[model samples]
Target: MQNFGLCLVIKQELKPIPLQNVVVEANIVDMIAEVTISQIYKNIEKDTIEALYKFPIYEAAAICEFEAEIGGQRKVKGIVKESKEAAKEYTEEVQKGHGAYLLESESKDIFQCSVGNITSGQTVVIKITYVTELNHDSESENIRFVLPTNIAPRYGSSEYSSSSNEGKILNPDVVSYSSKANYYLDLTVTCRMTSTIQNIESPSHKISTEMNIDENPKISKITLTEQITYLEKIFILVVKSKDLDQPRAFVEYNPETQTNCIISYNKKTFIYTALTSQEILTIQQVARVKSTNISTNTWINTLEAFRHDLQLPGKIEDIDTKEELECQLVLFFVSCKQQNGKDYSVQSIKTARFAIACHINLYSKIRPQDINNKNVYPDLYNAITGKIKILTKSGFGESRGADAFTESEIQLIVNHPAMQTDSPKGLLRRIFWHNAFEFALRGGEHYDLKIQHFVKRKDGGIDVIFYQSKCNQIRLSNSNPKSEIISISPNENIIKDYELYFTKRPPQCDDAFYLQSCNQAEVEFTGYWYKSAHVGRNSLNKFMNEIALVTGINCDDRKFSNHSGRKTFVQYSKSRGISDNDVMSVSRHKNPHSLSYYERPKTVLQQNTLTQINDIIYKKRVVTNEAKNQSTSFTAALEFYKGSISENCKFKALAYLNYHIAYYIIENNISPLPLSEKPRVPFQEIKDSQNIQLDEDCIKKFLQGNTFNNCNITFNMNQ
Candidate 1:
């Protein structure tokens, strides 16, 4: 059964702000990230999602003032706010050929120079972008608002970008745009800025909306990260058998809570608590936004520089985007726990790196002239370009249950022709292949096979001890990297070790059935018909694409696709808000290290997560209060808590309309975003600007009378 739901990003956007002296400051309040809550939760259950938010807190304190440069240029001189006082110095893990960058909605995943400069009085239009790890869709399809809403909040367009107050632009190609409003904060006001603004938008299929301004700090640019939790949902912990001293095995949960901590089959009891201290350390270190390791940056930087070159007056629009791009693979560990309280780990595969590789693969064979002339991009072209190679051992262990992978699988990836080749595709492919072994671990039954350390005899099959990053370097003082812990290799030893624990089941005969899904990419890859890799993305992706087309499933178009699998598992864990140690036990990743990646700006989805956490705290309390009763298990308290949230927790918005649309875009796709509104938002001057009657036709089509307040505004979309 596909008990887990797909987490595809239906929409997204990205607004790049070049670090220029004059335009150093950025804001998010009046930007696209700002919107009314109703549009955000229009169709989804409010309790099921959480968000990872990152917004820059300008070094306001450091800004003494702005100064003019030698050429009469102006720039701001200031230090950013000091790093979080609570943040400890964390040494970045050494990883080659792996990093992160935002994929643009209109622009492909390829990062390129987007915005430039002008004078302070010129108005710049911005866009928003989001990177989603949810359900799959076509590669880089632009979702323009069927009707342009470039105006401010007050006056109405055919629709707001699904939320928020925006204006209408009958012609999209027009550059120097103007708005109706004059002031903005909670509202978009008209002003002018100098330069081409980087626009970022949400990827959700938006419904027309109108924004109402309220009192508060407005948002502009935002940085997001997904918070993964609650991986222990399918089962609970118990002992192996009834014997006082016997080998323990992980089992599934039974509703009843027994008096003894031991399992019905075995009497062995675990010594650790549900959540380990190692797990409580929420974040390891806050990293620089979109920073990349050297090896991985080669392609990324090259792509960045190349994109910059493309914006020239004579710049060709049809340049081979895939050839000029760079990509890498990275892996992070995850945690997992079985019914018997035994901890295990496994590897998850990543497909994001592959996506990057696919793009780069497209570029290798493209000659400058061919790129200039050809409209069709092929896959096999990557086998030709001559480029250097770099490899990254980005072993991430943020989740506990995702640690038991062997190197053989990694070797398979590392040795691919593309990986070993000097071409861009080769370098990209090699990184892709090498990173595969890290996230190869699957959940459920596959995780059961990773139980290497028997309770009776402590044995670590392959050791993976993590050292926390302190002061920017991994403090390996107490950890050993040489230990042989469980790995993802299909070598005889791993297969045997796995077979010793979990039995192989017959393949599911269902049409959509798949097996051993860790990153949860178990769907088909190829389209309806088999196709050759005339424009190959290496044998691996070509083969996968074929399957995807046939199965209507998709493989990740990004590198570190394996790691994404483990990340998905962690997201599942966060959904349940399972105890840290439980997360570690199931993921097999150590606790302290596991907590680093998930700590981010909390979103609406986390409301439910905290609700679960509150349930945990309550259960802990009940365990203490009812100790005298001796009739109920500690779990009874938890059951009571789960019941309360299930029955009583009301689905609501955090900040009504302004942020309600956030959840939709982050999980969907990306669009453009603006920093500050110049010339004000359209609706702020609704009474004076356009005739409200102009929008009558489209207004009826959008709302269809879903739930209209007295305002009852109308629109036709065409101004």
Candidate 2:
């Protein structure tokens, strides 16, 4: 009875400030998904407090909506404003002691929320909504959705000079993951698609799925099996659909105008998406306007000519046999302003055609009609023995700028003992490495060449084939003839080295370059070739490092990879003051932008123009002093001195002029070098001038001024 009476006066305290709950709901469409997150923050402490929460989502997500509720009753919609204004408003509201909340972006994938002025026994709820595109892997046709949870503490300067959209990234709530509050998350997902769902799964979180229909699934729902306690890892889900392996087209028709259009291919092929409809119409309109001077047919012919001049890879053959279907396909592509949803240069198309022909024979179902009607334009004469062939060499990594080979480094490698004693392999390696450095050949291009691709010019030079790389094919054209190489070898016997390597060259294979054994009996070495460009690159780097160590050179700081050869060429050209355009010609870089990557930054002392400017400025400052305490200016004094000098002593006069300039530089503190602090002049040579007169007093007057206050200066004549 006493306890019951005491309960009548009990006070209601606030909750212990834990994140009471979290709810994540997602609605996924064909290529886009919209997500909403609800978080409940209850202040369990007896005193009023503010809560700060930092979280992460998908990088591409666009946050479009935010709202907050106080004490489960009062709700206010969030207004989007400029980052600074929003921050200011939030601060003002919080200071007034009104319950206020602010949500802001920290990075592409991260965000922060601050809720202020929660009274005792009060709870706050924050609701955030965002949308993001679902990533689809074209090669696999699998849809991936990732909800990031791991938000690493970003390291950067805390001070921001100005306010911008990125200003929110500097929020105080953006603390390190270790210091973040313990939070629980609950996730649910709903996805609908026109295509049949084959598999739905999560790689980062344990989840359960429910389908609307057991068979021929189209709609599905997924949920995490348990609430996540750690926001330190990601939640990933993948949805794979059936018929994804088959090439499919999406056709939408507008009944209002009876207009039908093909939008895309499995949302992966980008050919039609490369150009906008308006842009395509503009091109056609320009062509139409030009056709007024000629016939419409003539304009069409002109377009065909322009396309032909581009040296596009495929051929225009008799699609007339299946005329209607082919016409429709071509019109569809033209209207879409895309070929295969990708822009393929003339060269890549030929490569693709050649590749197709090479494998056409592998299929048993291939028919005469199929061969004749197939889109392989200019038919391959014979893939194996043809002049034009698609050669395949594999490599995956891009060239990362490593080290530039110095002239001394190249010479050291050229003279390594292994080049002479290690038989055919060593000799071959030496020649290959030298030529690669001089010519700046990319690893893949060099590895792909064959003997036929190299021509021994009559003028004791070599001509090698070069391909402007493309995705599908090695496109060939008469315009892309062999690049001529003038011999710039270190050794005088480079021609002899090349001749010897050719003599020891392994028996001919489809590939131009092959590895041969020093001993002819080694069958395994007879036709050894690199499987990929990466393998050859690694081998060359290893060989160079080994040689460098043997030569007592430090290779630790430098990365002597295959790209080093290219970088070395650029560096050498720059040192010789070669123009960027001229360097691009030898490097075959399509533009100056691509060439800039190879250009190294210049050192302060290497700036010759700046050095010249400094010399001129300091010389003028020294000359300025001559104008003071003298009847004539420095220029007038120089003129008088030059007139007094005899013809034979003219060289000495120039020396005297330079000496005075140096002396002035020392007096004015212009030169930092201690040796430059004094004037350099030969006094005996000046005295020996027979045509001129000079004495110790005259010399002293010229250098340090006369002792007399107002003496008219005169040269002492030799009488």
Candidate 3:
């Protein structure tokens, strides 16, 4: 079999100069950094040029400011208007011959900037400012800041590209390594540390640093060296603090809002508590990072902000009593078995702010200072819930949908060698999960598929239970936000696959799957086995990419992911004319809007409407035009003239003659033009005698079964 391949070709040869210079400044304070980027552009072309450029940034960063400077003067500050209003104002200003610039978020991490009416020899400077918290390297306790230099190409279905702001990122030619743009960058950083600073350095570029020893020794200035010219890879700066690794807690109050907040954390869990509106608001968020080192890393996993707010108890003295905390439920209870096989280890869940917040009511009870003097929870159960009520409201959280896979692609992935296993434990695990996914199992629900959740009946039927995120912990009712149970017959392929898998499954790890041994010797190995549900999602994502590569599917991580399977199930079911309710029953999607997102318009070839219409038109045309051989000689005569002709010259000559011949046939209802009025290409001709002679020669050659070269044929000039 041929190797799967994907090729991206730069189709446009006209590379216009888009940028002249870029200037960047960053100021770091504690965990937050504010960055400003300024880009200069000059239009040398005689006509006015409207420049549209897509830029990248840290996904977590919030854009706070924008401005445009025309001809080194006339500054126009950007307003955070609605997208439509911004576009309208930009168009109106540009129509009035005034320079305008509009900046809009393309995605969480990408932004599009449009500069209008840069007249000849005019320079325009556009600046953008944003703020983001610095990411911490857990092992080294160093804070890292990165500025993205290149936009990674995104891939998806045609409908996905058209419906979303993905066109710029999906363009093949706008790559990180493209040298067509001659823009260079000048970057400077000013660092201010709360604790004593150990050092500040850049891994991506050489830097010159200046220390303010006479002033605050903790403050420093750094700039990239002159040799670094291209903004291709990320510009990464790391700052190490001497004692920031210790467990810490702090409280702050905002007088304007009359809000008091306490933040406390060690390493695993972060607690945030806010007192506002006469209510105590507490959130327990977790952080998951794949890399333990400060070295190479791409993704920082963050969970959604889980918020819980309740009215304060009637008496301040009642706060410490357990009776007042009756309504609260510990939402998460994650347990991982250690390799030693005897102990059960508590696992910390990674939510958005796990390392940040502390509820005042709970903090006073646990007295973290008395326990460990750090924010790290002594027990997972304690960290999960502390007199906190489970928030009752249910609604859709913001999440981008993944593209669905084609049927063929799905089959290829399911049939891939990696999925086919004979080992007892591995086989059973793979088969069960693969079948589950085929049956429309969602990523979130996968965690609920434990051994207890599976029930095999005596009559060869099996029922598997799973839970949706909203109703998983605290249930409002049985049917309102229901837990789903999917049943499969014994004779079904899914059952057989599961049976085969379980028979050969390994004995050591009874969990659905076990983590493969780490390749590095020095790395601390977690002996705990993984359930299909608890595996790092990134691992599954990596597997999805591998499947794409092996299946010859044209997809990237952004387009095809673990969620694609669920989407595929929904789309395929809907395409088969299944009602939304029926499909939702199995899929457990509570909202119709969630399911409707997959109902994108079908591709052109899949529409069939246009093809059917064309087919009917062609058939009718065939019936009316009974004389099928009407243009036989004209085609042959054109072929004769085209022999040994230069392609460009032939195209020009043949196009002129063919159009005139077509016109004559349509208007005069003739088979061929008469010899007296021979239709010929421009700068070429055949006189009456020449046409007759050419016909006689063609007939003779046909009779003799002889081929004639272009030299054997003769043409009369326009004279």
Candidate 1, run of 10 with poorest lDDT: 34-43
> Between 1 and 2, whose TM-score is larger?
2
Candidate 2: lDDT over CA atoms? Answer: 0.54
Model 1 residue 71 lDDT score: 15
The true-versus-predicted C-alpha distance at residue 434 of model 1, in Å, is 17
Candidate 3: TM-score?
0.32
TM-score of 2: 0.31
Residue 563 of model 2 has an lDDT of: 59
Query: What is the Cα-based TM-score of model 1?
Result: 0.18
| CA RMSD of all predictions | 44.8, 34.8, 40.4
Across 304-370, the per-residue lDDT of candidate 3 in tens digits comes to 1111123333322134544333212122222211236332211122231133222222344533322
What is the lDDT for 525 in model 3?
43
What tens digits encode model 1's per-residue C-alpha lDDT throughout 1-719? 00001111224422221111111122221111112100000112223221111111111111122111211333222222333321111112111211111111221111121112222332222222221111111222111211112121111212222322223232221111112223221212121111222233434221121122232112122221222111111111111111223333323454687333433323223333575655553332223111223223444444344445445222222333544321111101011223364422212112223323433333344433232112432322221111001111222322332221123433443444433433323332332222223332322212122222322213433332222111223334636433323333445543343333222212322111122221113223421111121222233324222322333333344323234344544554554557777555535565547655643335745864565456457754222222222223323332333344322231211122112223222222223334343322223343533443313233223222222222323222231
Q: Looking at candidate 3, what is the lDDT of residue 41?
A: 57
Ranking by TM-score: 3, 2, 1
Count of clashes, each model? 197, 12, 23
Q: Could you give the candidate ranking by lDDT, starting with the highest?
A: 2, 3, 1
TM-scores for the candidates: 0.18, 0.31, 0.32
